[model samples]
Target: MISVEEALRIILEESKALEGEEKNILSCLNKVLAEDIYSRDNLPPFDKSAMDGYAIKSEDTDLYKDGVSIELEIVDLIKAGESSDKELKNGQAMKIMTGAPVPEGANAVIQIEKVEVREDTLHISEKVKNGCNVIKLGEEIKVGDIALRKGTLIRPTEIGVLASLGYSKIKVPRNPVVSILTTGDELVEINETPKFGQIRNSNEYSLKALIQNLGLEALSFGIVEDKKDTLKSKVKEALEKSDIVITSGGASVGDFDFVEQVLNEINADIKFQSVAIKPGKPISFAVIDKKLFFSLPGNPLSAITTFEEFVKPACEKMLGKNMESDNTFPVILAEDFKEKEGRSKYIYVKIKAENGKLYAYKAGSQSSNQLITMSKANGIIIMPEGIGYKKAGEVLSGKFIFK
Candidate 1:
């Protein structure tokens, strides 16, 4: 068995960023930009109005005093999506709505509420500064200017910006196709009642949910018998149809654990068969034909934890996303915890923020097969591989799970 850090290093070294394809802007949400996007036109194509008010020359309001008001004739009215070609004179103003194009020779706009109108005339007692309430053309972005840089994640705001810049489609890295294969004769369908020694298969469902949480689709091959030949054929089939194949059982050293054997038989480069981590120690990683393969323990919690720690990074790299950042932080323990002193332990806990400091408390039993314990936990505290027990008031690294 190798350390978790070394195993992850091998997996990431083999994962490659996939090529990009053109897609509608709406479909590119949460995806990384494949290239820099230049603005096709000025952000505000014309001198536009930022408010519903009168467009006038700033010089026209220069004579206004505290008690005295200045009046300018209202010549034309412009609403949103409308343009006026009529130019304003020294004492003329145009009633313009928000988003309407400001008429030529108008250098400022006085808000409608700030001014009183008396029969086609505008009245204002305050001096209007130049460019006031006017969204100048190209103020935000100019034609041929870089609007968005490569590797930027597309959000809702990016969608609107792309649309405003006349881009209906964008190029983004393709989401990888992931397949889940569950193995074990002792497992039955979720809807089926398990016999005396059998148990319902929850690993397949949990794996699918985890894959979907990354915005990728999952194809699951129902439970395969513990037979060597059958599992081998299914593994080959899954690898042939998917960019990443995940098997949820038969990864340990038991007689029926055939993942490592099958990987060798298939001529795959089996990088590692185990990691020094609790609840998810038996994890097999391999690569063949540009496809990633991960064999996780049959325990439901182990399967989910290994997937998040190992498989999730491969998928993220294929999608051209940042792969090195984690949300871990120093958290003070509020309860004592016990464990063996060999592998790293991920203890599920309920985290609370008190006075700007995070404190972690035990949620329930730290059993490897208990998914309920994980469900009750909002976060996890990482215990070092050299420590067997942690006392209350001790500090350790903690981070939220499934995020």
Candidate 2:
């Protein structure tokens, strides 16, 4: 067995980022950028009017101070997407809409609400400061400026920035294709009514959902029987088609456990057979033909916990992103909890804030087979090894899993 930190380090050190591909910006959401993107032009290509009002020289409104009103002749009207070549001379104003380019020689804009218009003339009651309500050219981003750095995850805001740069297509790291397989003789399809001593297959679907949530493609190979030959055949097929293969069950030491044997038969390089963690000690990791393989525990909670702790970071590394710990917070334990020596413990809990203090309440049973507790939990309390027991109100580090 190896520590979780050592296991993760091995996986990341062996992993390599996938090659880049040019994809349409519309379809690149959540993809990591492969190259730095620079702006081709200023964010606002020209001097823009920030408000829908009259554009006039700042000196024109100077005399209309302290309750005095000044009227100037309206020379032209400029709306968004429209340009005016006419220049504003003294005592002249232009009715410009928001986002419209400011006419030449106009240094300020007065909001329409602040002035009363009579025909082509405008009355401005307040003295407008120079450059007021006007977005100067290149105010936000200048030409050739680095708009986005490499390895940045593309979000909606990033999409807007790319659109402003006229990038219909962008280069991004390719998303890894994951294959999910489940093993057990007592497992039945989800639609079938399980007979005595049989259970429905839930891990496959849960793992598939989790893979999709990470913006990766998942191919399900269904459930394989707990036989060495059958498991070997399924593993071969998954390895041929996917960049990563994840299997649940048959990894622990038992009479029916044959996943390890199958991997050995295939001559896979086993990185680790076990990890020093509770509810997930039976986890296995191997690499076959330069492709990654993860053998998770059979229990539902254990499978999910191991996935979050190990597989998530591996996937991020493959997608050309720096691995970081999931968000965590310090919470006061609402109840006493015991930890086993020489093994880290992950306890499911629900977090609640009261009186500006965060509290973690144990959620249901912490058994690996109990799916109800995992479903109700919003966070996990990590209890390090050697800590015998913790009293209520003791501070513990917790990571939010949901919301």
Candidate 3:
């Protein structure tokens, strides 16, 4: 049995950076950037008006001091999307609407409501500062400036930014194709009635949903019998088509656990097995022909926890996403915690802020098969080996799974 850290190191050593591909900007949302995206041109591109008002010179009116209103001739009326061909002269102003290009020689803008227009001449009623209500050229973003850095994931706001910058395509990492498999003779479909001691298989559904939530493609290979031949055939089929393969159940140390035997039968290059963790000690993982395989525990909670701690990160790395832990916040124990020594343990707990301090309360039960306990829990409190029990108010590091 390898330590969790050593197993992780071995797993990470097998991973390589995913390749990049050009994708349509619309399809690039939520995709990781492969290269830095630089602005093709200055934002706004030209000096434009920011308000639906007239453009005038800053010194056109003596309104800066006692607010002297000046009468100026409105030579042109420029609305949004229109440009003024005529340049403003001393004591002259252009009636420019919002988003319209500011006329040359105009240093300020006075709102139309602030002026009383009589035929061609306009009377300003308030002081106008230089460059007021105007969006200068390259004000928001300059040309050649990097709008987004490499490895950055594009979101809706990023799409908007790229659209505003006139980008129709973006370079993003190639999303890996993943296949999920489950092996058990005592498992049946949810819609079918279990015979004798068989139970409905929940691993496939939960694992599929978890994979999809990570923004990747996941395919189910259906359930295979726990027999070595059936398991081996299923593994080969999934490995032939996918970059990563995940299997749940048949990973424990029982005599019927054929996952390890199946891998060895196919001459799979075993990477690591049996991580030093509670509720998930029987996890198995291997790398065969550059493809990844993960054999999760049969217990639902154990499967989910192992997926979050290991499989999720592996998938993210394969997708070129910079994944980080969200549950690094300091949390105090709500009550005393006890456990056996040796293996590291992860206990589900409900975390909330109480009296301006964060506290964690243990969930109902610690049974590996209890999915309801995990559903009611908010986070996992990590208890490393040799540190068995913790008293109330003891500070410990934890992670929020649903956050």
Task: Return the top candidate by TM-score.
Answer: 1
Ordered list by lDDT, greatest first:
1, 2, 3
Better of 1 and 2 by lDDT: 1
Candidate 2 per-residue C-alpha lDDT over 1-403 given as tens digits, one digit per residue, 9 for 90 to 100: 8887898899998777899999999899877899999999998999999999999999987787676689899999999999899989999999999999999999999898888999888988888899999999999999999999999988999999999899999998888889999999999999999999999999998898888878888999998998888899999999999999999999988998998999999999999999988879999999998899999999999999998888987888989886764466899999998766677888999989899989999888988999999998888988886676899989988888733
lDDT of 1: 0.91
- Among all windows of 10 consecutive residues in model 3, the one with the lowest summed lDDT is 60-69
Candidate achieving higher TM-score, 1 or 2: 1
Superposition error at 172 for model 3 (Å): 2.2
Q: Runs in model 3 with CA error above 4 Å? A: 61-64, 67-71, 110-129, 324-327, 354-357
Q: Record all residue pairs in model 2 with backbone atoms less than 3 Å apart, i.e. clashing.
A: none
In the range 48-159, model 3's lDDT, one tens digit per residue, is 9888888999787765444556788888889888898898998888888889999999988877677798899888776778898889999998999998898887889999
lDDT of 2: 0.90
Better of 2 and 3 by lDDT: 2
Order the candidate numbers by TM-score, best to worst: 1, 2, 3
Please write out the lDDT profile of model 1 over residues 47-128, one tens digit for every residue. 9999999999999888888899998999999999988879889999999999999999999988989999999988888999
Better of 2 and 3 by TM-score: 2
